[model samples]
Target: MRMSIGRRLSLLIASQLILAALGIMTSIVAFRRLTHETAYLRHYVFEPFVVISSGIESSNALFDLLARPSSDVAYDARRPMMELRSFVEQYQRDWLTATSTLPEALHLRAALDRAGELGLLNEELAAVDTIAAVVASLERTTGLVGPAPTAPFLRRADVEDLGAALAKLNKINLRYMDVAYSAYDRNRRLILLAFLSVCLAGVAAASLFGLAVHRAIVPRVRRMVTAVQRFRELGTYEPLGDWGNDELAVLAHTLNTSFKAIAERDKDRDRFLAVAAHELKTPLTTMKGFSQVALNQRHDAAVRDRALAIIDRQATRLARLVQDLLWCARISGGERPFNPQAIDVQELARRVIGEIEPVASDHSIRLMPRGDAHILGDPELLEQALWSLLVQAVSVALEHEPVLMTIDADSAGRELITIEVRGGKDLPEDLDRLLEPFAVIAFEGRRGEPRGTGIGLHLVQGIARLHGARFSIERRPGDIMVFSLELRR
Candidate 1:
């Protein structure tokens, strides 16, 4: 359905807003997922790794102290051993915290070879306590004698067993690191994929919207522009194609209607010019012939008088033609003044019939006055209108046929004065064309008669309109043609 411009714009904006909201929602969800993944990695993987690594460094320091003699040591080994034991305790506490925070469904089992090898996480803490006891015993032994025990004083088997325990703990920490890191890597990949997907979706949506807008608007604008250009250059444009209820479609319909009106006016102007030329040519030709004759026969008085009379007649015709043209112009421009008064329309009809009687010598003219044919109107304009119609009827009347002029009041409730000219001839099919200025009639009734300037009916119609009267023509039975004017009473 067709809609106004405002409605169409609203629809477009609403669609864009909805799309934008979707994009924003997608971005928010993706950002939240990324944030959660980052928090998980820091707590489960990175933070625990840092604590374990610190404990390992502290253990290495204690081992180095044991490898040296006690007399040569610059600092006491007891403090270093105590610090190492404190780090071990801290590592255990941090491991417990890390496990407590781990998700219910761990994604790290694939990274571990055997859960039993490490036992429970608490078992690992017990092994650290055993190492602390061994270190304490060694420290006591060092203080007792023999300038600190030699590096090989501890049994190879005992040292190897302690190293194996540390190795197992280290292996467990590394394996846990491997699992945490794997989970972190996978989380990173998923976040990246989601972000990329959102971006791709936003771009795709934008592209589709742009394409849709272009398709909807560009062609319509182009068609309108082309139509205007053609109208300017060639004075015509093709009819608009089907427009499916957009704002542009309504605009196209309006413009096309105006174009058609302009074309019709242009056609009318051309036809009027041709008809004017023809009307002027006939009188001018007659005047020229008579003037030539009068000039050439200067010696013959009778010939000159006859030529002058013919010239006078032609001049009168020319004058009337000019008068009709001027009246038409005045009426069309609304410059003609009308002064209306109460007048008996029957008397007006009598005056018009008397004026047209001489012109219709071959036909009988009659007046049929009925009722009180009274109307308030301009007497001169009404007379002119009646005269024009009577002359037209007489000109086209069949030989010996009667042209009747009637004046009467409307019998209907609407009080109106009607003037009708009923001619004894069949109405021509082209009545509308006949009413136009300078329209030529080619029917049997007009065959033997000389054509008038063709402005009579046009002028009559104009005068009738000026009097607020309706003018029309109709055919009745018995081959009667009636031209009528119904004036306001």
Candidate 2:
């Protein structure tokens, strides 16, 4: 589905935020696990070992008192025996409690089972109690304790046995510590691996997403910018393709549309200038030629008079061209003011025919009025339009082919004024293009080059538009062409 630019950006941002949130949640969970591991080691591993070590130290002291006792050592051994018993009891309670919390510590659990099988903590407590009983017996007064108990009460063998038992349990505790520490290390490593995995996955996902976003948006934006830059430098550009139904695509479409219009208008302006130059050059050439003749042939009054008249005629033609050009400019710029009034259609048609009659002596000009007609229009502009249309007709009409002008109402009995001029000559193959400015239809003339400014029909079209009239052209085989102008009455 096509998403708009705003929605797409929002989705991208939302995705990034979701990824970040996931990363943060992973971190929090990892940290929680790390904290739990820390507590597990303290309670299950380190603290239990502390209690076991203290018990072992006290047991060694107890063994010393029993094996070789001076009076001072004997007095101190009493305190050590009490401490050994208390330490052993504490170690037993804590070890069992700590083991319950660390179910996943496989080696630690195994070592705990081994300690229990060895009768480990029980043997240590038993030895401490037995030696206390022997010491109690040695201290009693039986006729002053039967010669002050000269031999050591507990034998070296018994002491050795107690030490061996203590040593065995110590070994078990050491093994348990090793297993617990290893478990802790593995736990740390697992947590670290998990954290790193989450981070790597998040980073990779973000990278892929970033690349996708860049591909979707950046290249399209770059293309539009490049197109605009090229247009700026050269006043021309190729259109951008539709990337999607996004804002940037719409922008690209709008720019292409505007540039196309500007290019077409530029083309029309160039064509107009060329045609205008040609029209001006022809009249200026004729005026220059006749003026020179009048100046050089001063002695001949007849020749000078004829040259002046010809010059005056050409000058008038140039003036009319200027007026038409100005009117075209005003209409195009929307500066031409409209003033409509009731006008006699027949009178205007007759005026156009009379004006063209002088130069159109070779071809007959006729006007057929079906009924008297009137229309609301700008009289001057309407008359100028009709004049241009008649002249254009006269230029293409064969000498023997009469140019006909008609004024009448259309089919619905609705009042309409129409002027139709037909010529024996054929129009250009592209009839529609012929309406464009500077478009001239090539037709052979019996005289010199056919007199056409190429601006007449274009100017006529503009004038028709200003008066809200319709202009059309029809042609038949053998180049029998007809031009029609329809106006509402």
Candidate 3:
């Protein structure tokens, strides 16, 4: 299907916007996931490990106090027991706070509990509490007022058990930290990869779209440019092939139409020149031959006078031909000025009949006036047009036949005046061609020579047009050819 330039550009823009939106949305989703994972590691993984390590240190300190030999062992153990109890309470608070802040951490804790890791850590914490209880009992039994006692209250086995529990707890925390760190790193890499992939896809799509647009526009534009250049150089039109329904296609069509019209006009111009040369040459040749005979001293007076008369007639014909050529040129160049005034159509027809009747001796000229009709026109141009039409009618009419010039108001109730020249002979089938400059309707005169310079009808048409009148030719029922001029009243 055909797409306009505007629609194609709109589609390109829309595609780019859609791709950009998709990229932005992908980035937002990936970033959101990364942020969530970060919070998960901080609360459930790193924070919990810190609290476990602190608990292990507090356990070690208690064991150290138990290992020392002292005169008042209970008094020394009292401070370590209080510190261990405080550490245990603080560890529990920290763990609770971390787990409570993130829902994902709570789920992780539940999973760890199912795996026995959380339970093992809890058991180790309970052991530390038991050791603190033993130290408390010793302090209660050996009062501060008693004499210095050297007996150690915490046994070697108890210390060993406490160390083992703390070690196990630390090991569990380390393993959990490792797992959390691995996952965090993996998720971050995945997010980064996804964002990069989305960006790459957008870039690829944009590149493809750019290439598509270039292919759609560039080749056709180049073709049109090439066609124009070829026409400029060769004076010939080359058709740009069908390029679908686009702006370029429409332009190509217009150029094709204009080029064809120019070509036709050129043909017409060449034809006009050929015909004009023939018409001008004939009259000039006649004048030249007769003038040569007239100038010869060997010629008698009667023969010389006859030759002079023929020369004068040819000159007059040549002059008329020249005048018609000039009028055609002026009309075509838009150089003819129109001076409109009300002119009686009947009176104009009579003047044109009088001018044409003397020359057309073989044919009778008649005026059929319907009424006193007046039309607004350039009087001089209108007269010339009427004279030309009458001359054309007289030349084409059969010998001894009447050539009628009819002037009246339009029969169609329109405010128009119509002047018609009717001749005894039928018009050529291609009557319209007679309106073209130097176009002749083939007809033989009494001497078997062609009558009328082809310019007469063409000049009449042009003059009628200058007065904004309609000129037409048609054949009547009796094979009578009629030339009509309809002018606004």
Candidate 4:
């Protein structure tokens, strides 16, 4: 099947939308993971390590008090000062190497400087030498009375300066951690929101695609199939039913056009058959009459009787053929007029069965009335449809074939009448077309069967419709053709 452009575009759009949805989902997950990692790196890693750097700096004052580079204090001080330098270097190196990005190294540098300026370095050598003089005075107290601690040289002012600088650096590092977490949280939320929006859009688009695909494909195929079935069974139908202006619409238009052309051509053919049947009927009747007159004067009894029988049989067959043709023409012309009325159902069934009684008896087929019923329709047309059904049934049942014909009406006092005709020999599968005026289908029959082209049922159906009746068919073991007249009341 050739897909419509709208369907192709919808598919393309749907595929793109699905991909976009997946992309959004991936982004949301990745962003969330990144944000979580950033939080961990800031608080668990950077924040803790920054505080470690501050601790490493604060420990420096102990080393400063021990470091006297001149006399006796140098030996004791050098060991402690060297240990402090190793500790600071190790912690700072760990902090620096653990992460390459972010401001850890910068914070470490500022922390080291603050630790140094806090009476641990000379202002003469940028505070280092001042710390040296204090260390020398404390270490060289060989003869001080009461050991007065060699006059304290590490001043409170130096400690205060280091403390203030450390506080400022710690605050800055705390702020950096806070900002990093805040930005991560914001970006994570953004990705999550975008994912939700994309999901909603995808769902809506999928629903629309489903509806559009259904509308574009299924109904047109159904309509065309239905029309063809009706045309095959009833020989005619209006095929340009309900459809839009898409390809489906174009298909319906083409179907209606083809059927219209077929009907027109059929009409022309029926006209010709009518003229031809009439022309043949006159000569056959005349020849039968002249031959019978000569048979009446014959002295040879056997010869004359055979000729007379042949003439009579030929004349009857010719008349029946002409009548069938005439009926087809009248039906095709839509000219089967009848008076409509509210009819008693029981009486209508009796009347139809009564009309077919002679033929049924002749063919040895039984006509059974099932129940009494009423309908609002033309009694004449209703009887005709039933009578046609019975006639077809009897004709088929003549070879000792058992048959059943039934009639009834629906409930609710709706005046809906029904007629069903059944035969012993299973009916032809295409028997539904038997009622179609110009649509003749052949069925197997016994020898000496009456010549017919399957037009009687067609005429009955046409007349029934002319008076507001519903025609329906069911093919069972034997064909069941039915007609129902809807109550006017």
Query: What would the TM-scores of all predictions be?
Result: 0.57, 0.55, 0.64, 0.38
True-vs-predicted CA distance for residue 440, candidate 4, Å: 8.7
Compose the digit string of candidate 2's lDDT tens values, residues 105-191: 443555446445435335434544544444334333211234544433444554455456556656655655665666667777887
Q: Write the per-residue lDDT of candidate 4 for residues 231-263, one digit (tens) a residue.
A: 889998675674556677777888888899787
Of the two candidates 2 and 4, the one with more favorable TM-score, higher being better, is 2
Mark the regions of model 2 whose C-alpha exceeds 4 Å error after superposition. 1-275, 292-309, 411-427, 445-453
lDDT of each: 0.64, 0.67, 0.68, 0.53
**Order of candidate numbers by lDDT, starting with the best:** 3, 2, 1, 4
**Each candidate: RMSD:** 8.7, 9.4, 7.1, 14.7
Regarding TM-score, does 1 or 2 come out ahead? 1
Name the runs in model 4 displaced over 4 angstroms. 1-18, 21-157, 207-236, 241-247, 250-489
Candidate 1 vs candidate 2: the lDDT winner is 2
Give the best candidate by TM-score. Answer: 3
Which candidate model has the greater lDDT, 2 or 4? 2
lDDT of 3 by residue, 168-262 (tens): 65665666666566666777788778778878877887787777778778888898888888877887877778557888788888888887877
Candidate no. 4 TM-score: 0.38
